[model samples]
Target: MKFVSWNVNGIRAAVKKGFMDYFNEVDADFFCIQESKCQAGQIELDLPGYEQYWNYAERKGYSGTAIFTKHTPLSVKYGVGENDSEEEGRIITLEYEKFYMVTVYTPNTKRDLSRLEGRLQWEDELKAYLKELDEVKPVIYCGDLNVAHTEIDLKNPKTNVGNAGFTDEERGRMTRLLKAGFTDTFRHLYPDTTDRYTWWSYMSKVRERNIGWRIDYFITSDCIVPAIEKAEIHDQVLGSDHCPILLEMKEF
Candidate 1:
């Protein structure tokens, strides 16, 4: 099976910039996207042979997520609980016979870190939610988690240590999540690989320099680690600040 995840920044804008081209080229079994930034009835995508499920933020052109899958899910859920995220539409869960697939757009802590406390609470709730689902079935979680996990994840870790995406607090939540029986499929396959990233700053010439962070990921239950066939970063893809990531695994 092939899975693809990308934070398109804004789905509407991405479409104008050839989102459909990459979408068609990838032809993923499950195409997960974050930061859709669109509301219902705002945009229509012409995608045949795929089931499109979207969780739109209450506010227009804000945080949102979607998953285009070839398989019909047994159940589909939006959000985790009654909190800000429910309104922001940051998560979507599709339940299948074998596993539950979750796509998320984790709340960013803001450049000033003013939302740090709330963001941490979000992590705690997310961890609990993933664990609850894991108790019932293995999970395949993928999305733009909004954090650069380690020094190697970003270009200049020393200068970015306390920044929003590279903060210690944010990285710790990821650590806790992995320790709770999940494996980051990319890292699990290539622990020492460097200079590979999924998200880049839209700054002057950041992407041109390849100075980016591998914030987007494909993570699965620890038990499924052995099934990971290929985990890759499609850094060459255009249309968003983030690039697409691919994960090929044994059919479960």
Candidate 2:
């Protein structure tokens, strides 16, 4: 089946900026979104053949995530735990008969690295949560994880060293996650590919210069690696600082 993930920045704004067009064109079986910035009833989206699920932050117009899926999930979960439920509506887990699908908008470490410790804690908690779920069934996790995994994941890794998202601490968490039986679908497909990215800086001429980070991803249990049909970055699609990422696989 076809699955797509995008950090729309703001769902309301993206709808007005050709989100519908891209949505129709892609026509994925599951459309996952992060940074929706809207609560239930705040916006209306008339997407046919899709079941909508959203987790909104208590604060207005902040971090939020949504899943639009053609198949109905057996269960839906909002956050990992009560502690993480407080700030940053970051995760949404959809339980299907065969696998659990999780979409996350990982908390970003502030430019000054002020939130690094919290982000690290989140990584620990998130990995524990995923492992707990994996014990029951395989998982398909996707989202804007807010970290450029390696030097190949960003435009200028040398200059970005020790920065918030590129810090060794942040990248180390990702390493631990993958080591814990998850496979980054994109890298699994094209390990040596370079110059491809998903999130771009909104700074002056950054997107134009293609200075961006491949922070968004689709990761699945190691057992499902053979089923990954395609993992792609739709960099040409626009509307937010991050473009859309696609992960196609055979239906379980």
Candidate 3:
């Protein structure tokens, strides 16, 4: 099975930049999107065989997520952790017979780190929620988590430390989550690889220079790691600041 995840930044703008072309080329078993920035009745897709699921934020054109899949999920859920998190439409969980697929757009704490505490709290609650679900079946979690994780996950980590997405507290949250029986597929596959990144700054020539961070991910329960065929960062495809991420796995 093939899975794809991307933070399109905005669905409408992505569409204009050939999202359909990439969507058709991938033909993923499940395709997930974060930062959709759209609400109901805002955009229409012409996908032929995929089922679409969307969670729109109360605030228009802000944070949102969607899932397009060839296979039907047995059950679908929206929002996890605290109820207030639901107001931004940051998460979508789809349960299949064998596993749960979750997509999330983690909150950015801001350059001033004003929202760091709230983001940390959200991570704790989200971890608990994932643990509860893991008791039943494996999980495939993917999206723009908004954190660079470790020093190796980003360019110029020394300078980026304590910045919004590179803060120590944010990285700790990811570390703890992985320790709790989840696997980051990219790192699991390419333990020593370097200079491969997913999200880049839109500033002048930043992307061309590959000055970016590995913020987007395809993570899974530890038990599901054996099934992962390959994990990749699609840095060449660009419609947004973040390029697409790919994960291939055997049928569970």
Candidate 4:
């Protein structure tokens, strides 16, 4: 099965920029999107063979996530059981027959690091949520996690060390999550790989220069390692600061 995740940045804008064309071309069995920036009734999509699920934030035109899958999920859930975090519509858990597919648009600590505390709190809650779901089945967690993980995950680690997304605190949270039995599918396959990134700065010619961070990911429970045949970063696609990341597995 081909599972893909992308941070469209805004659903409305993305659609206008040939999202449909890319959608058809990629032809993933499971497609997950983050930073949708839209609410119910705001937009309509006519994806022929896909079942759509969306979670929108209470604040209009803000953080949101969606899942488009060819196969119907046995069950679906939104939020992380935390009231404030739930308000932003950042998380969606889709239960497939063999695994749980979770898509997230992780909260960004502002440039001044004002929301760092809140982001950390969200991480804790999310870790708990993943652990709970893992008890039943392995998980396929994918989205714009908003952190560059390690030095290798970013283009200029030295320069970005304490920045909002690369702060030690944020990276530590990600470390804790992975240590709890999850594997970053991409890095797992290409350990020590560098320069390949997902989210790029919109400023200047950053994308052209490939000055970006590998903040988006496809993570799974350790047990599913053998099933993950390949993981990729589709840096060519544009419409958002982030490009779509791909994961090819044996079967869902």
Ranking by lDDT: 2, 3, 1, 4
TM-score of 4: 0.97
The root-mean-square deviation over C-alpha atoms between each candidate and the true structure, in angstroms, is: 1.4, 1.3, 1.2, 1.5
lDDT of 2 by residue, 88-149 (tens): 68899999888999999999999999999999999999999999989999999999999999
lDDT of 1 by residue, 204-228 (tens): 9999999999899899999878889
lDDT of all the models against the reference?
0.92, 0.93, 0.93, 0.91
Taking all chains together, each candidate's TM-score versus the true structure is: 0.97, 0.97, 0.98, 0.97
Kindly report which residue stretches of model 3 are placed more than 4 angstroms away from their true locations once superposed: 81-85
lDDT of 3 at 220: 98
Q: Which 10-residue window in model 1 sums to the lowest lDDT?
A: 78-87
CA lDDT, candidate 1, residue 158: 96
Tens-digit lDDT track for model 3 on 168-248?
A: 899999999999999999999888788999998889999999999999999999997999998989899989999999999
Backbone clash tally for model 4? 0
Which residue window of length 10 is worst by lDDT in model 2? 79-88
| lDDT (10s digit) by residue, model 4, range 1-252 | 999999999999999988898899999999999999998999999999999999999899998999999999898899765442477888888888899999999989999999999999989988998998899999999999999999999889998889999999999999999999999999889999989999988899989998889999999999898898989999889888889999999964
lDDT of 1: 0.92
